[model samples]
Target: MTPEPNQLLRPSLYVGALVLPLLMSTSALAQSAGGDWSYKIAPYFWGTGLSGTVATSPALPPADVDASFGDIWDNLDFAAMVVGHANNGRFGFSGDLQYFKLGNSGPTPGPAYSSVDVAITNKIYSLNAEYLLKTSSTSEVWGSIGARYWSVDAGLNFSAGTSPAASARSKNTWVDPMIGVRGRTELSGDLYLVGWAYAGGFGVGSDSSFDLFGALGYQFTPTTSGIIGYRWLSVDREDGSFQYDVEMEGLMAGVSFNF
Candidate 1:
């Protein structure tokens, strides 16, 4: 028997809520011990562009209608993460817990009116591991992999004068496998430049997607640093009325502390 949609999403929420706290606690303990553990907390912001296709089938009397390139606009993106790294000045390992939110609103074609207002929101949580491939007195390179939990909700609300006067909403969840690379190079005594890119996919349902990012940072001390960056993320839904595609590129700044 197939599980209900809510049934599937509920478990993901529960698991994320339970695991996030545990990871945070473990990271804290490692920090107090002065082990090869370090943590970074940062807030990120992005501007977004969105577009999608909506299909209405004949069974619904729409005769297989298609809505293309629905709408595009700039969006405010927000994200925060707690990351821990263990680097013995050479071989290294890292883990991260991250949360992100993206939202946008715009005008879309309506049945009998010029357009209707639509809004979309996306929330994601990720846990990942990294390995350093190379480290020098001024630069270091690393690769990473992990699991991502994602949730998206989208809706359309018609104007008061639009025909049929309607609204629709949808939600989906997925577990994606992710991989990426990162590097850092010193620019001064207490400052460094940083950059990274990550991509992932969910093979089942409408969860397939990819994300890429790049950033630069400044070290305030031996164990603390601040960074700024940009990212682009996209996801495709295999079975739905809508095909999802979004591009987010903007400013992100955050801090990291190593123990």
Candidate 2:
């Protein structure tokens, strides 16, 4: 038996309702603080390939999915991402939001199905507070604590010969508390290496989620830079009827401005 569309999306809706307000409140607080605030905004492109399994309800077994960056780009219908940072002295706040909607058509198992189409929407938001532990003209390091929220919606439609199309959908959302470190080192003249890694979800929201990134950046001007990096991120979560164990990794490039 297939689940209703609304049934699959309820979890995400609930999570959004609970978390969005917190973000707004944090922003308000930051603005009201009287101090010289420095800011940075970075917009980037990630050519991430997806490799994962998605299972909905016990009735439907997990399906393996493998898509290259090329495949993902072809199916991607919409995408938006932004990373923001604000700092006052050694105390600071950073946040990033990423959203994507994609669709693909392929073959599926079982004699009852001739073709399968899947549409997916994913949103990931992270907000963190960090205190600078060390700083120098050539390097800096910070310790961070934050929460990351993930919400996903997937719709699957199956085509069975001589039978009407059958559709199933699922949505799930969770928030994980994470601790990590971010740092940068000057490698050469106007060149730097930057990296960050975080792990969370010790049975709190999901079983576990880990994110890692390393980038080489070059300063183009006093307040602008270009960055190229490789990133790996994975998540394993089982909440009631929704289950997902997935990993994404790829190359990314972006531009940043500091003011």
Question: In candidate 2, what are the lDDT values of residues 3-56, reduced to their tens digit?
Answer: 346643653454446446655665577679878777777777676666677666
Model 1 agreement with the true structure over 35-134: per-residue lDDT tens digits: 4644454434333444454222211111111222222122323334445455443444555554443344344443553344445556666666677788
- As a whole number from 0 to 100, the lDDT of residue 101 in candidate 1 is 38
lDDT of 1: 0.55
Best by TM-score: 2
- Candidate 1: residue 239 Cα off by (Å): 3.0
Per-residue error for 171 in candidate 2, Å, reads 1.8
lDDT of 1 at 200: 73
Weakest 10 consecutive residues of candidate 2 by summed lDDT? 1-10
